[model samples]
Target: MKINDVILRTVTKIVVFIILTLSVYLFFSGHYSPGGGFIGGLVLASAIVLMYLTSDIETVHKGMPFDFKLVAALGVLIATGTGFASVIFGKDFMTQAAMKLNLPIFGETELASVVLFEAGVAMTVIGVVVTIILSISEDE
Candidate 1:
């Protein structure tokens, strides 16, 4: 498959950046909004796939800073660690806690431990999906 159209490549670059930004926003706003790590990760993975489709595999690899598999493993470790961390505090595994912090612009905000777990989920999802896409792309 070849994609040599300049317009398509330019559009893809703009769209990929937008999607990536939106994915991060979704991941961060997940706790209070409808979006979450799962959706965010999916969106991010899709953006990466779009990049792969618009350009060569070498470009995609260069764009990505690290290995997806390592990311997946680290995500798993983080999620598992977060769960066990609760146990260390005498709380049940996966128990969630929140704290209120006063900020300058945002005023008062509540930060939850679950956010870390969601981050792990997001990273794992991104890693798994990217790995699958790259593997398939390479086999062809």
Candidate 2:
């Protein structure tokens, strides 16, 4: 027999949103403070895992129709591509460049290649972690 979890599901909805919000904050704050892509990705993965814990795998998979392995591959490609771009410009591998740009919403901001690299790292982490979690759950 299955146990009813209406309350758990309701709370999960709110908690997941909060966690995702925090992850984004952590990702953006990495440039200035002590948070970054790896932590952000872990937080994001936790939200996904929480969802899975609250519901069935099929439902979660239906909502997130992504092949995590592909995600990881793409992340690696993106990260390496950023490095190769520096090489193409006669700089060392993984060289990061930054520039100041004035955008309408954010005003003057420093844009850096490190953000792209971090994004790739975040995606890779999310993919690998989620894949591992799913694989482990499958053994049940």
Candidate 2 ranges beyond 4 A from true positions: none
Encode model 1's per-residue lDDT on 46-83: one tens digit a residue: 99889888887888778677899999998888888999
Clashes of 2: 0
Model 2: residue 134 alpha-carbon error in angstroms? 1.3
Count clashes in each candidate, considering only residues at least 3 apart in sequence or on different chains: 0, 0
Residues 1-140 of candidate 2: C-alpha lDDT, one tens digit per residue: 98999999999999999999999999989988989989998999999999989997889989999999999889889888998999999999999999999999999999998999999999999999999998988744
> Roughly what TM-score does model 1 have, to 2 decimal places?
0.92
Error of 1 at 84 (Å): 0.7
CA-only RMSD, every prediction: 1.7, 1.1
**The CA-based lDDT of model 1 is what?**
0.89
